[model samples]
Target: MKIIAAGLLLMNVAFGQTQLRSLRAVPVPEPSGLSEYVRDKASLIRLGKVFFWDMQAGSDGVTACATCHFHAGADHRPQNSLVDPNSPFRVNAELSTVLFPLYLLSDPRNRNSAMVRDSGVRVGSAGTFRRIFEGIVPGQAAELGRDALDKPEFMRGDMQVRRVTPRNTPSVFNTVYYVRNFWDGRAGRTFDGFTVTGANEAEGPGVLVARNGGLERQRVRIDKASLAAQAVGPALDHLEMSYAGRTWPMLAKKLLSLPPLALQKVAIDDSVLGPLARKEGRGLEEQHTYFAMIQSAFEPKFWESSERLNAAGELDPMGEFTQVGHNFSLFWGLALQAYQSTLNSDASPFDRFMEGDSHALTPQEQEGMRLFQNAAGCTRCHNGAEFSAAAFNENGSTRADSFERTGVRPVGDDIGSGNGAFKSIGLRNVEFTGPYFHNGGQSTLEQVVDFYRRGGDFAPITGDLRAFAATPGQTAAIVAFLKALSDDRVRYERAPFDHPELCVPVGHEEDESGELKPGDVATSAAERWRGLAAVGAGGNAAPLQTFDEMLRKFGENGERAHTMNEACTASLASLLGR
Candidate 1:
């Protein structure tokens, strides 16, 4: 019955930076002079949340930004999460516990020993069908898209399933602190208000802004707004959400005409959208268009011009849009970042303990913290208030990008950040964001620990990883400490973390031979999906499940080591800590 007290500790983080135990003390890097562009911050956040969850935002009318980022700001679905990385999204298959640690060795300690498994199939989120963008169908959520002519990889006979992303999806919660977003640091430190790769785009014409009665190519350069930069990317990617040839103006045109969160139900008590929610059914009470939300959030110069911009999408050659519709990218990106900025999970048990609550963490968990800081060498990358070297405010030096070549895979495979260096991601809410790493090869936090214990899978250019001997007790303690990082608010979808309802596609009815399970789209139902019910600011009845819990439920019938039946999820949730 030994009691442990967590005293406040200050330590030097990576690259000559200092960080305190209490994360709230760290100031997130925000773009100043925002008042010139933003009209109302609250309205901007509301617009962001609604846009993130609205199915109408997707060209297919189903795949919203929240589809890949619902659970704790990251995807947790196991079915159709894997893709062939070597071939670069050649297949989208169900990932299982049996096939993991993609590149494995027979001897854990030996790197040159006989290989057990080397799978090219990496874990990622499933996205849109293979289709070409035609035009905004005016009042329709779906763009007037035609099926692609090419023989697509993600297919069951003639039926087109969803394509998977080559990279694993990261959480959007703490991204406001990142100097650059994505595994590849393509989402640059500065946002030009147009594209994610705006920094490296050779000083091209920047984001288009509406002036008196004409379009002006605004040379916008807002620093520390990488979240805004990253926010605009997936919305137009052919595999992620849009059809081929869909442009910003076209997508914007569609969204401006539609009602906010039209296809989804908003909780009446929602922190941001509650007052706007309808009294009895789906959508908001005002029945206002997304354009109205934009008007409420952004400055008049960005949207109030009388100019009409021609649609740039190939299929929508005849389509013309208003000034507000044309600059949708800038509005969407900034607003989403504004909403995500409030999503920082600084209320974990570890945070409370650091802020002077001794009983916040168990003694074993405190011991785990010590090992994590010292013996485990976790702080070399996972350091600072944000728990990531990639955090802009973490390091005094220019290492906030924190792109390290840890040799998880060969440099020739992906060439991330130029030389196989991936961004060192933050570790907050890690308990809920499993399937770890950029490839998402690990299933649980324990497996992630095991990966580090063995000095990583590939080692041609290992960063700071080296073999370490840790006992079972030490490992358990470390894992418990990791779990302590889970913020109660995020786990229950409370306050700023709450959102509208969403229906994410799980998988299609298909066999191993890539054949459909008979019937039409309704019967065979490749579009088989699951609903994530709306949670208000008051929070849900139970906390969200860890990745493994949902993974096992989605696993093959009776193949999961734990579950007797998949339907037992809700009943067993009580025993499983929600």
Candidate 2:
């Protein structure tokens, strides 16, 4: 019976029923859990945007959320984006692209194999300077230097430098639809106004100060705010964004006193800054402190009395904690969630096609769409408006087809719910979000399609791929269909997606022993600023290259470029028509 069904599917493809299906339109919903203190949703969104890109938010006063998510909602910097040496699937000897066919999986230590050049696991780049110690240590925070390189502790190896995150950085675009954020789905659906596990545990100040001076623990119970829960994860994560021993209170204190984007320039017409916009300038400005923004965006009750008084009868930065100070995690989480919730990329070509605009997608794209739903079996996991089964339903229920074990790695390498199961990420802007997969083991869409074609590299695969076969043309059509998921506003950095200038580390400076020194990491801010000067005189932040441009610049002889119709054709030749 199964064989007959497969034969019938093939027959349907032969009879040209591929273009019969269309993607459903998933409308972007308003963010949940806005406090009564917030007078304007638009103002709150602006505050979220500012905080999202503000460098002062980091302990080093340089790194921002935008550092890793700079290009097309995903990191595009090639240097320093390599896998750790101890990683189970470590293949590349150094930082380089992961090539096709002979991927790094069979042997963990085989670096001298004959395969495509620059094909290794691509991890996201992070801050080079971190707290000198491994874990939380008292007095370490005071020893931190503004310039990590100049700090004797870091220079002499007393402090540990930042290391690559275990998994690749997922794009923040359209993340509002996720039922649970993170590859492990650790960010729960219920934001407890505190930690990711707050839903299960009921220990924290579960209430907020009411506008009329009343206090209650249940004032803020955010639902479907996984992005908010996910937002606070990186701020405290030692590997991704913070120094060890750093608490939300410490980060909040540091940010409250410092001016937002102190190290970078804010465009005068920045949507987030509005009336608070300072003169077109660089460096820190006297106006628009994070404290002021927080006060304006939130109810006065949340921040006005949340501080503890010191011996001198003044509010202390670290003396005592209040519901507001403790609620910094809540504010940080929700503000980011509010901003990211607006990053819906529903204006893609495929979106138009789904909305009944018949000519929005080309005939080839239409054919590809059909193949995506039928022959490719992509609809099994990537169904609905977001092209992902993990997305929240219109009625707010989570679809059961969320996580799957595609066998990207061997079964026991990184064990979780199903040994190797990872989130089925949305395909929107997939062309820009590469090296594919949670481990970033594949470099292009063709490689991704090929992986699915072979039913994954390891055993115990989750999805059925027995009927999942396609020709080269069919694969190319599928790639085209994926590209149609990209939204143009994201490519141009327009409105809700607009961000401040960010200086991101491209590579690390090597020490005497070839170890990465804290100060040796190179940043793109100066170069980006120079580029911004050459082309324009306005206050709008400069735009980074689209994924296509990055591919052309980084790929060998344009063979590795993205978005081009033939980009994956050559690499996929040997695997086609299987």
Candidate 3:
């Protein structure tokens, strides 16, 4: 009878739906030893939010981690967003309506006939212009630099445009559940607090935590802190945030001199920072120094030490550095992780339905849920509450399940999962994260569904994808079901998702002024800024646009996806020949 019951439960799981709230998130492991690094969790979270949104943190003083993540935890700007893999500059193509469905078949029903269009242009976030580092201009959130002739492809006429990241950024929402982060899982589960990779991969002595009346180089492996590990990479990455040769110490020294959010305004009703907010106008009223925030949020051992260190982080014979200045990266990574962990969005319509609110979902959405689990078999890989097999509770013992090859791209040597493996990102707010896939090839959820429904666009198949036919109504219902996972809080920038004003570089224009700026390299691309107004805990009234909505000219092109198949590879092999 017990065996029969077990079999029955398995059957139910196979066909029945599972609620997102049922599964446990990957535990956010604190840094080892030192008891706890945080003296005040609330203060620490506030610090994290400030760091994550502080544009001054960038070498140019105009970018932030929030720049790429401003829209529902993913980028949706249509201009200068497409990446052509063959381009030496890495990206130059602009996104447009006709260029989508990246690998479209002439016939939606047929796997092979003749290719109608394959733009080879994909989506990506635009970052800073490539320039050799000089040094920070004293007392400013900017750098002094001379330009070098970077890749000629990056050059447009006499000016150079901003560079684009190679991969499509995954949403940061509900990322606390992932065992590993990033498309290739380069951001490991154990944060080292120093290296770009995980602690296990760190080469040097690791994070410098003060000990025994003096500073010490100790290797601290904070478990379940992939978010921390992930947070450390982009800060110094010349392509992403910093100038070439920018060091954490340099960044720290610059920030320590400035008050919290000295470059931007803080909302009076900010979810986390409101208590520290100014009574009127911009910035905090108290002039909370980064040093003070660190001192309050972290233990005395972290910031109380007066150890003088050089740019290399070595104890200098003659130098002026505080423990806070030397170990800023560690604080930055962990605090950012703390803030991101709070960005959970488990309150969507589907979540409400799972919580016993039957009317939360429409009748068709309910049927779509049935099809997603039973017919579509989406639950097999996208199991658990997070709708991701990559969630730690679902695949703790295996790294392979952390990735899958829907065959979005071709196999290549040493290329990150170049055989098309990518992170099985959670689909909580799929409506807003546009230009789907690691390649950022597909433009809308409908386009994504169509890619999956007819079979993924690539070949040499072997994975969780295969062609299966669905009626138009069934397809629409599945899309509707996916949309039901979106949380209104995320959509409206409420509470944990609310952020400070950030000026993001959306595109480039001619340097019409023809005047050299402090960081200008050979008349670097005159940037165009898209200013985001700060939101508070109360959230915004305007609804964020879906990727489909953002791509206004795409029409109804968002209405397609490949069907999920448990065993259809042998049939698709010839159809999608390598």
Tell me, by TM-score, which candidate is best.
Answer: 1
Residues 89-169, candidate 3: write the lDDT tens digits.
333344566777777778765667588876555577877777777887556776765566656655655666777787887
Estimate, for each residue in 319-424, the C-alpha lDDT of model 1 and write its tens digit.
4766676677889888888888888888999888877688899999999999888898887788777788777654333445578887777778788887788988
Off by over 4 Å in 1: 1-20, 87-92, 109-113, 149-151, 200-215, 312-319, 394-400, 511-514, 517-525, 554-578
Put down candidate 2 lDDT per residue, 1-578, tens digits, no spaces. Answer: 55654554455345431222233335565455465546567667767877787655655445578767765677776555555434344211233332433364342222233334433344545553545323221212121433334423212233334456657788988888878888878888777767774364545545455445544445456778788788887777655667666677667656665556555555665555534555655533576667666776787767766546332224467665555556688788878888888778778888766555678899989899888888778877887676677877667777654788887776665554567788878888888787677777766787777777666666677765433667889889999988888776665566655556565545445556654443322421111111111111232233344443454464434333221221111111111111
RMSD of 1: 5.9
Q: Better model by lDDT, 1 or 2?
A: 1
| Best-matching candidate per lDDT | 1
How much does candidate 2 score in TM-score?
Answer: 0.77
Score every model by TM-score.
0.88, 0.77, 0.87
Q: Locate the minimum summed-lDDT window of 10 residues in model 1.
A: 568-577
Ranking by lDDT: 1, 3, 2
- Pairs that clash in candidate 1: 81-124
Q: What is the C-alpha lDDT of each candidate?
A: 0.74, 0.60, 0.70
Ranking by TM-score: 1, 3, 2
Model 1: lDDT of residue 329: 81
Quality of model 1 by C-alpha lDDT:
0.74
Better of 1 and 2 by TM-score: 1
